[model samples]
Target: MKSPETFEHLVRAEFTPKSTFLNTATNALLPARTVTALQDAVRLRAEGRPLDPLYDDVEASRAAYARLAGVPVERVALGATVTLYTALIAASLRPGAEVLTVENDFASVVNPFHVRGDLKVRAVPLERLAESVGPDTDLVAVSAVQSADGRIADLPALREAAREHGARTYVDLSQAIGWLPVDADGFDYSVAIVYKWLLGPHGGAFLAVPEDFGDLVPVQAAWAAAEKPWDSAYGPVAELAHSARRFDTSPALFTYAGLRASLELVEEIGVDAVHAHDVALADRFRAGLAPLGHEPVPSPGSAIVSVPGLGRLQPELSRAGFALSDRAGHLRASFHLYNTPADVDRLLEALPG
Candidate 1:
């Protein structure tokens, strides 16, 4: 049987730029199966037949994603999370409604709040999010994990606070979903990218909106998102899918195929097992940091470890043939299924003691 690193090597070797290092930010790359699936999906599209089955695949992909995310299939919306969030924020808000957010939220999330008209913005401390969800705040939007610090927010508290104020909560689970366990049941709505942790292709994301908000329209719509099936007789109308399909931006065949493969891989290795492995890798990294006298920031101590190392680690790590990320006052290390104990050890050896 192939060892874990051997399996990773086989997958990585298939890609170019022979250095073959894994990116710590996204944790893993497209495996051979995903690449093949993408090629097949593209070839099928070239034939020019109606891809109603592709639509079914899209629905199935979200169902698989919802199961992995611990949410009901009815709650899942499939699309680019950023695009979906823009539509959701637009639909959910009245003119001049307040959106309470934190300082360190991801750019994709914060941008929608900033650009939207008829919306007032309120910034709050990352820790005091619950307290900031005041009566006037119509929506409490946050990244489940702060992109800057990699801090995991206390989601339940945020959900409770939003409910107390008659406000809705939108969670950006891009950085947290696969690495850690997220209870989508807690938030009124949530958005996440599939590429980062689900090991899926780019251009695919998942959104879980509450059942009651079924009437809420997505500002961005495609023919696939129409109320009726795609038939020649009916003209294009943005009636939207009654289910989470309302967020679809047409059928993305290649990406959906890649996403389906990744989802299958995730299922093969249970999410619970994946989370355990990731958390253990993170714990190992944190423990090693102490020996080098490098301290990790308090909040994102596990799964993703961020630290104020001696200098910008991106170039240094890159020069050393290691894949890692640096941003917002700290160097971030994300652990995924592909990472091994040896990789962690090598990372430690590369850092300044």
Candidate 2:
């Protein structure tokens, strides 16, 4: 782990936020290196130079994310959105199979299963998620961290319950990956969008699956999913990749180019360090909220502090240079690696009495 002074230095050198940005749950601000990488990718296209380098960016990001998620590179699939990966998982289920999910989970994690129309989808509160898994449950899908209020799902309990019930687990890490320690190997399938806590641009997402790729159908498989993409470009793919690469979509090249740098930065700072830093700031904000007559949602050990009945203040907060979110009438503020004590104090000071 990096020392606090070193972590602070690295964070300051990488990010130059223009606001008291507390909304990493909504989207992350790109680091300076990522911005440079994006600019370079655009310039490379403008010059019509050989596009070969961008492909390396894609693979590097995949490997980096695989490492972060504690999965083998061969088990990770690259894609543009979490929904696409969720749809692939959904398609693999037999008709009438039940998927148990948390109520009001991010749509990408739950809607794909529901859209299948044939699957029996059940919604339960986050607290009851693990205990609700039973013999009838074929799969358990939920976000590792709740997006609306940052209530963390008990993944270990969920995994144990799923295993005991002869069920599979699918975890959405979109809001948890960068700052939270997740063991992707414990779940049957897990997906994350890089633009949020990963601090990358839009257009990059990842799906991690078990060694057998969770028997996903790869319904959208194209030449990109082939064992030899260039050789298989024209015809039906001679052979799909034997690994999870077979689930990959044609990547957004420029996005991955920037994401590579951003992910590398996260690797350098370490997720544990980021988790400690972010949660501390969030705790600071939470502690001060009550003194101001505001109560935050009860989310212990989370880096997101959400206050119910304060959604109307979002516009006022934004105008005052506090960047956060209004989610279903809750004022949601998420702290991240780039956030500081001063940032949290400023938001608290600006809040109404």
Candidate 3:
């Protein structure tokens, strides 16, 4: 485990954002090492060198992500987006199956099931989600941390509720993974895009499923999903992978090359350490908000703080070099390992009274 001082020092050395970047809930700034890896990948392609290393990077990321998510690599599938993975789950659902979701959650988690047209989709407030699960609910899908206001879902309660109702759970970890310690194995299915809190490049996502691959059909399967990819290249997959790899979407090679390095940094610092660091800064920001006459959205134990009615200040804050997001008229500020108390205080100082 890295000591707090060492972790802070590592973060300071690795990230050099020109702005006080506090929008990690929206996207993360790549660390210097990841940037170097991406540059090397591009150079390799430009120089017509062997692309073998890039493929190695993809496998390396799969292993690293599996470790981070606390699941066997066989249960993890590499993908380009959360929506594709969610769609695969949606496809597996029988007609008239019901999906319970959090109201106003990220669209990627909710839209796919609704688009199916035949499935019964229901949305409820986050606090009421666990209790809302019923015998008719086939799946309970929600983000671990809500994107708009950073409210954390009650995963344990949801898990218990789903189990009691004979329902499966699907969690989107895009806004939670790096800073939040999640056991992906707890869910029947989970998906995350690593670009946000995982600090990887866009186009890299992961899906974790049961060891038996659940009921998914891998409707988007390609050569890469075959048991023997190279041998099956010219024809339809001779045999789909027995594991969750059958659900994989062809990886974006360059994205994985950078992601390998980013995941390495995350491992070194550790998620628990990052969580402590992030939530402390967010609390500091939250405490300061009231003095500035701004009351933030109630989100205890979260690294993202959203102040309702402060959306108008976002453009001015951006111009002042404080990076954040304005979502549905709420100014959302997210903290991560790279953020410090000074960053929080400076943003507080910049807020209008």
Question: Residue 156 deviation, candidate 3, in Å?
Answer: 0.3
Q: How many clashes show up per model?
A: 1, 0, 0
Once fitted onto the true fold, the runs of candidate 3 whose alpha carbons sit more than 4 angstroms away are none
Where in model 2 is the C-alpha error above 4 Å?
Answer: none
Can you write out model 3's per-residue Cα lDDT over 1-353, one digit (the tens) per residue? 68978997898889999999999998899999999999999999999999999999999999999999999999999989989888999999999999999999999999999999999999999999999999999999999999999999999999999999999999999999999999989889999999999999999999999988778888999988989887878867879998888988788999999999999999999999999989999999999988778899899999999999998889999999989899989999999988889999899999887
Tens digit of per-residue lDDT, candidate 2, span 154-270: 999999999999999999999899998989999999999999989999999999989977667888999999999988889688899998889999999999999999999999999
Instruction: Write out the backbone clash pairs for model 3.
Output: none
- The TM-score measured for candidate 3 stands at 0.99
RMSD of each: 3.5, 0.8, 0.8
Query: Residue 131 of candidate 3: its Cα lDDT?
Result: 96
Cα lDDT of model 1 overall? Answer: 0.74
Error of 1 at 332 (Å): 1.2
lDDT for 185 (candidate 3): 90
lDDT of 2: 0.93
